[model samples]
Target: MKTLTIFTPAYNRAYCLGKCYESLLRQTNQEFIWLIIDDGSTDETGKLVDSWVKEQKIEIQYYYQENQGMHGAHNKAYQLIETDLNMCIDSDDYLADGAVEKIIHFWQKNGNKDVSGIIGLDADQHQRVIGTRMPAQIKRSTLFNLYNKYGVTGDKKLVYRTELTNKYPYPIFQDEKYVGLAFKYYKLDQEYEMLLLDEVLCHVEYLEDGSTHNMINQYRKNPKGFAFYRKELMKLPYAGQLFKFRQAIHFVSSSLMMRNQYFLKESPKKGLTLLAIPFGLLLYVYILFKSRTVKHV
Candidate 1:
């Protein structure tokens, strides 16, 4: 069996998905499986993937699901994955050359049951590292501490063990599509730290239609999902009180947007949630205003 499964959650990305596919074909190490989670694409993505599958170049698995947003697609991928390790390479992004080799050798040398997986780097189109590099001194850190305690910045690639990724299945809210992806990462942080691999693994380009580009619209439209995510973060035992308070602020904002009256009662930190009410109200108003003029990604 291959050591790693590189999964991509795609949503109508036929235009750029080929770039991701081409990058995989260029991999120096072919001991990885490419699993594409087709999140109900209306475009030519399925046909394109079929063409690649017909060529029989690399191992590929494609699963089609009704439009369930990114988190639902992720839930399905975790269920489908059987490899020892897996990491998401978004449809619009592609892996760096020899990244599979780097991860395999690094994990073979450094990995153990004690660690969750590897945390690698992501570069921009011009090959610049997307945020500050991982802290040089540390060999491993939880996803939360890497940013909050160590002052590391930017989006980093995360490779997780299949077992762990399967545990925290993100909830699909009634009509909402987004749940903060970090909810699962922070949950895993409570149990394990990820090995820091400083090499760039994937190159990312945030297109206009991507979720990162439309966070505010997502927040406005998916308040229940956001509220659920924020509440879970507030319960993290390893996280600092300040972090919990911040989550409470967002929880309050999302709850208000959803018109959930039991928000204070539902919060893990009721005191913090109460204190956050005024700020949350203001935030809700700001989001409502922003939604009037902005378009959803």
Candidate 2:
């Protein structure tokens, strides 16, 4: 079996996909397979991938599905991967030189029965670390504590044991509000602490229309985003009413920014939690004012 399976969920990224493909082809380590899940792009992505598959230069598996969003594409990757370990590189992302070789070697040397997989680093398109760091060693529970206390700070540049990643099919919460594939890593952390490699391997392009840039729209249009998170919050131990209150406020502001008046329109049902809005709004304003003051100063 291949040591690693790298998959990219792409949509209308024909321009960048070639760069990603070229990087994988040049990997010093040929111990990995590539699975490209086209997230229903209207572009010529299918044709490009078809050309690559026909050439068969490397082990590339491609699948086309209706656009169900990133979460849906990830769900498919989890199901289809058949390697010992799996990692995801975004469509607009590529790996660094010899990065895959280093990752495969690290996994072979350190990954074993006790460890689930390895966590690497994420960089910008120019190969700058985008902020993902974890301790060398940590118990699963402690990791969750860190996440709950400070929120998830790092890019989850994680590779998971294929078996573990497939345990929970991507959660398609109401209205498809799953937060990408976060719960997958969170759950794996429950059992195994991933081996950390303090090296940048993947470079993600922060395009204007990328998913990361659409937080406001997602919060506004996907009312279920709050509901899904509410469920996850309940699953955490120390997430109290205060925590939920803060989150509710954040969601409200994000919705308003996206021109989504869900909180106002659904006040009777969804706005019972509006009680937290006043404090939330005050905090938001304070932050904005502080930011402006700092700029002037």
Candidate 3:
């Protein structure tokens, strides 16, 4: 069986998908499959993958599906990948040279049934480290604690055991919103610890068209996305009401501080920041003013 399956959910990313394909072709080891989910691309992405399939001498499977969100494509990838280990490499992002070889070797050396998965570092398109390193040891980590305690950020840098991930497929919601896959991975942490590879294996590019860079408007307009995340967080075991309430405050406060429209949309509906109603809007406004002052100063 293939040891790894690397896939991307791409929509109209034909121009950039080649970079991902090229990186896979350069791998020092080839115990993997590249599955590209052509998430209803109207562009020539199908032709692009076909061309790459002809030129590249690796295991490549290109599957197309109706445009689901990124999480939807991920749901499909998890269902289709028949491998022990799997990862989702964004079409705009590519792996570091020989990074997979290193990851596979690390897994060979350290992982077993007891360990759930492996986490790696993320770097920007220019290969600069994007987030902090994984902790040397994570004691009592939950999904939120991974971010809150271990300081692990960025939804992209982790790899998972296919069996465990497939078991917990990302859920679809009533509207077009869902909790992030990172939350799902964190929930998995309740059962297993991820082996930290401490290496920058993927180069995450910030494309103008990419979801992270451009989805603010959609998320703002729909707003249900934020509700989806809040609901998921509250559902966690021991996600106590007090803790949830406190988290709700922090979340909206942070969003207001950042002027993230999604949270701005959420703040009123969920009454998330209004627990301290008299000063809540003032606090948000103050934060915004302070940020602007700091930036200008």
Q: In candidate 2, which residue pairs clash?
A: none
lDDT-superior candidate, 2 or 3: 3
* Model 1 Cα lDDT, one tens digit per residue, 71-188: 9999999999999999999988999999999999999999999999999999999999999998889999999999999999999999998888988899998888999889899989
Better of 1 and 2 by TM-score: 1
CA displacement after TM-score superposition, residue 4 of candidate 2 (Å): 0.8
lDDT of 2 by residue, 115-187 (tens): 7777677877676677645544552333444456535465647778888877766656555544635655656
What local distance difference test score does each model get? 0.93, 0.70, 0.72
For every model shown, the clashing-pair count is 0, 0, 1
lDDT, residue 228, candidate 1: 91
Ranked by TM-score from best down, the candidates are 1, 3, 2
**Candidate 3 lDDT tens digits, 159-268:** 78898887666766555633466667757876886676768889988887676654443444333455455545645664556656654654564454345666545543
Regions of model 1 farther than 4 Å from truth: none
lDDT of 1 at 187: 89
TM-scores for every predicted model: 0.98, 0.78, 0.79
Looking at model 3, report the run of 10 residues with the lowest lDDT sum.
Answer: 214-223
